[model samples]
Target: MLFYNDYPLPLLGWGKLRNRFLPDKGKIMTQAIFKATIIAAAAVFFAIFVAVVVPPLIAQPDVVGAFAAGFVNPYASGYSSDVLACWVILAAWIAYEAKALGIRHGWICALLGIIPGVAVGFALYLLLRMRQLKAG
Candidate 1:
């Protein structure tokens, strides 16, 4: 038997040492893909915000007016209403999960949900939730 850092090496095989030191490749790949999807969702939504909103925002610079415009028509009103409802749902879930899963900084996502919209906030919250669950 050999010794490493004052610890005796396994006599059977090196598989135990590799398993103890390295994580599963498949698991790592899956986790990376999952995190990338979440980040990509946020990035795509942010790009949409910049393209669809930034021009008018730069010209008018009226935050309240921009928000009120979301209800300018019946269709717009419906969409805006849905967005608000989703934000409420997201906030409620965040609050519940904070206690149940020990997720923190969820309030920031809730606030972002109202401003930049639900897609970004929902994605961010999912990322945070994944990280917390993985840690546990």
Candidate 2:
């Protein structure tokens, strides 16, 4: 048996580090790290939304024009297209996983995807998925 940080690794070998050493503690640590990453991503993306989108929203409040601005140029259009595609991908995953994993409230993330952006919604979905996985 090998050792890591003074813990004995399982004889089953290198299949899974968490399974090999620190079992429950390792799983907890991994889950905490994953949740923190999701929260951090959501915070950063939401900050960008507030900084860039809120200003124009508060100033003129032109919802249609605000959306149109995303495709104003070739570069913007490309990025906008990518975001739309990503949202579609997320929606599909959400739909499938809701059925497969019995995860609830995924629709809220879908709505968030449209409003604040995909990153926030994606992070929220990940957190939800993590919770459901842990529960099951």
- TM per candidate: 0.72, 0.76
Tens digits of per-residue lDDT, candidate 1, 1-136, equal 7655445667677767656765555544686788888789889989999899999999999999999999999999999999999999999999999998789999999988977889999998998888778898
- lDDT (Cα, 0-100) at 35 in candidate 1: 80
Ten residues in sequence with the least summed lDDT for candidate 2: 19-28
Query: Clashing residue pairs in candidate 2, if any?
Result: none
Clash pairs, candidate 1, are none
Mind giving the per-residue lDDT tens digits that candidate 2 earns over 13-94?
A: 4677655545654554676788898899899999999998899799999999989998999999999999999999999999
Model 2 earns a TM-score of 0.76
Residue 74 displacement (Å), model 2: 0.9
